[model samples]
Every structure is written in C-alpha cells, then in structure tokens.
Target: MTNALVFLDTETTGLHHDRRPWEIALIRREPNGYTTELRVFVADVDLSSAELMGLNVGHFYDTHPSFRTDSPMRLPAGDEEFQTGPGVWLAVEAKAAVLVERMTRGATIVGNNPTFDVEVLAAMLRRHKLCPAWHYHPIDVVSQALGFLSVLNLRMLGDLLAPELAEDLTPPVKSDKLSKLCGITPPEGDDRHTAIGDARWVQRWYDRLSNPLDGDDETTSVQAQ
Candidate 1:
C-alpha cells in the first residue's frame, strides 16, 4: 500500500481556535514524492500595530515563495477586516472534509501535535453544522519518536534519532545553528516568520540525517530523488 503522510503546522492569534489562523503549513509525503503548501489566513488583526510588531512570525514567506506571491492568501485591510465568516470557515471545513475523506482511503495524518489541530477543526466543523467526511485519527510524530527512543532524554533522544536535524534551531534559538554545525557561516539576512519556511527547514534537517553529503558548503539545496 502506498502510504500517505501529512505534516501539518499552524500559527494562530494567541492559543484559541476561535481566534482564527495567522498561518498554516501542510507538508505531504507519499510514494510518489514530497510537496508542501502554506497559507496566511489573516493579517493586520485587531491587535495594535506595535503589538503586531513583536510577533515571532516564523520563516513563512522566505521558504514558500509561491505563497508569498499568492493573492487569495492575502488578508484584507481597514476596519472592514476579515472575521471568521461562514464562507471562509466553509472553505476550511470543505478542505478538512476532503483531507479526512482521503484518510479513510488508508492515508495517515502525521503531525507534531495533531491533538489540538484535530480538536479545533472538529469543533469548527461542528459549529458550522457541517459533518466533515474524514476520521480524527492522527499519528503524532514527536510522541511516537519519543516512545521509540525511550532510552534517552528528550533533547538527547532528538539528537540521537536525527542528528542532522539537530542542526536546525527550534524556536527561540538562532538560525545560525544549522550553518554553524556545517562550519559555514551564512550571510546576514532577515528571517521571514512563515510556517512554510519552517517546514522546509524541518524537512531539510530530516533529509540531512537520512542521506548526508560530503560537502562543506552549507547552502546546498538537496532535492529528494
């Protein structure tokens, strides 16, 4: 059977599902290949301009160039701002329904933390009185990996299980870790706080562990075969 695995990531306004999405990233890997898509559902929200300034927006734009240029992903402006309208929620619910429906055909949803995502999406669908066409079962990557490497502590186990991935910085850490590990110092650049970019980095680190190259250059984009 061809396994369908999906890695999903989301950024939202605070921690509440009712707050709406600030960003969403989904990375899918199948027997054919791997592909990723990202969307920024809202922008310039109710918070003050200064408050918005302090947000730790991940590298959403830098990694996902296509999304950066997409029109529908852009949020509206002014007091006539976009709230969680029925149509918008309907679209999300529809997509979730499709994703869930596909899963019933034997696909597995893999995520870092799927409990929250599934809960929120389920609640949203119920709130809209729409029955999604998929199941709620999800394979949590972090938990499974932890269980697999129960011998080591969390930090050490992460490094041991995926040493190459250890190079990438996980929130709050400088992005320099990856390059620095490779002994290559990257030039000065601002990181775009986008989810797609973060997923790309995570994927890169995962890739590096499985198939390492004998290169000293840090900027190599290793495309999967």
Candidate 2:
C-alpha cells in the first residue's frame, strides 16, 4: 500500500464561511513511485451569493480555468472549452464521471482543512447525482502536525526541544505556526488560492510529518518498503 494516500485542496467561491468549491486538485502517490494527479474547475457555480472577498481571494475572475485556454491540462476543444450548447453539458457530465473513479481510488482525502474540502466535494459530486466513495475519516494536516510535535509536551524533552514554546506562543498554537515549526512555508501569490498549488502545499506538510523519526520510522518505513 502507499504510505501517503492523497493530498487535496480546493478553491471556493466563498470565504471561510459556507462556500462552494469551484476548482479541485489532488495528488495520489503510489508505492511504486508513480503519482496520479488531477486539476479541474467546475464551470457551473452559483456565484449569486458568493462573497466579494471570496471571489477576490480565489481570483475567481482572473484564473478560472474556463477563460485560460493556455492551461496545460485544459480539456480538448469540445470538452470544458464549450461554454454553451449541448457540448458543454455532455462535457460536464463526462468530467463528473471521471471524478467518481479518480477521487475514490485513493480511498482517503488529506488536506490542511479536510472537513471543508470534503464537504464541498461531496456537494459537487452530488450535484451530478454521483456519490463520494472516499474514506469516511478524512485526515487534517494541522491535527497530524500537532500530534507529531506533541513530543515536546514531554516534560524532559519539552525543555530540550523548542525551548521557546513556553515563552513565545500560547498553548494550542495555530495551524500556520505549527506548519512553520515543521519547516513548511505558507504558499503565497498565485499559489496561495489556486487549487493545484494549495494541494501540493498540503503534500509538502504531509511529507514533513511523515519524515523518518525515532520510534516511528522503523514501522512505517518497513511497510512502505
């Protein structure tokens, strides 16, 4: 089995509040070193209620794959390119069918905030009458990083590793801070809100958390090998 199942992210039309994900990206790593990836934008979204800030942050107007014909992964002329007519509807349905297979094959969804991502994904899938077959329990990278660093809570080691934790930040540090401690630099600029970039960013954090460490590396490494 693959040690790391999947890394995922989405760009939505609303802010942190209830929103709909219009763009999706994910990466699945296999034991044999092959990686499967997908990046797509769902053209159909009800932006009537989308927040102004949400549209700004996600660059909804600027980088939406529909307008960007230069995208390397852009579907052929008749596919996602068609904005109107029967072609567009067929393409959209075809894309949804592909997602049903690809999204569930990995069987797990992992991300910085997986709950929100999965919720949007489920809604998107259901819109096309498809069901989400991913594992019920999604993995949150922030929680995983917290657990990885929880070793510092040990009285003896707390004093030895990251001595400034007691003085600098308060208990229950935020997700961004925790990621920094794990040597993950937050993505910025275009990478900040783009689906594919953010998904890869999540993968970076997952890689850090999965690093070989004392007492844990032996078991995981053996399984991976």
Worst 10 residues of 2 by lDDT: 216-225
Scored by CA lDDT, what does every candidate get?
0.42, 0.65
Candidate 2 lDDT tens digits, 34-143: 55666656665567678879778787777665544464234555554333321122135336445634645646778988888888777766767777777788889888
TM-score for each candidate, following the candidate numbering: 0.46, 0.73
Cα lDDT of model 1 by residue, 26-107, tens digit: 5555546644333334343322322232233433333322234453343333232233432122123334433333433344
**Residue 69 deviation, candidate 1, in Å?**
17
**Candidate 1 Cα deviation (angstroms), residue 166:** 12
Best candidate per TM-score, number?
A: 2
Error of 2 at 188 (Å): 2.4
- Model 2 alpha-carbon drift over 4 Å, by segment: 1-4, 15-18, 67-97, 154-172, 212-225
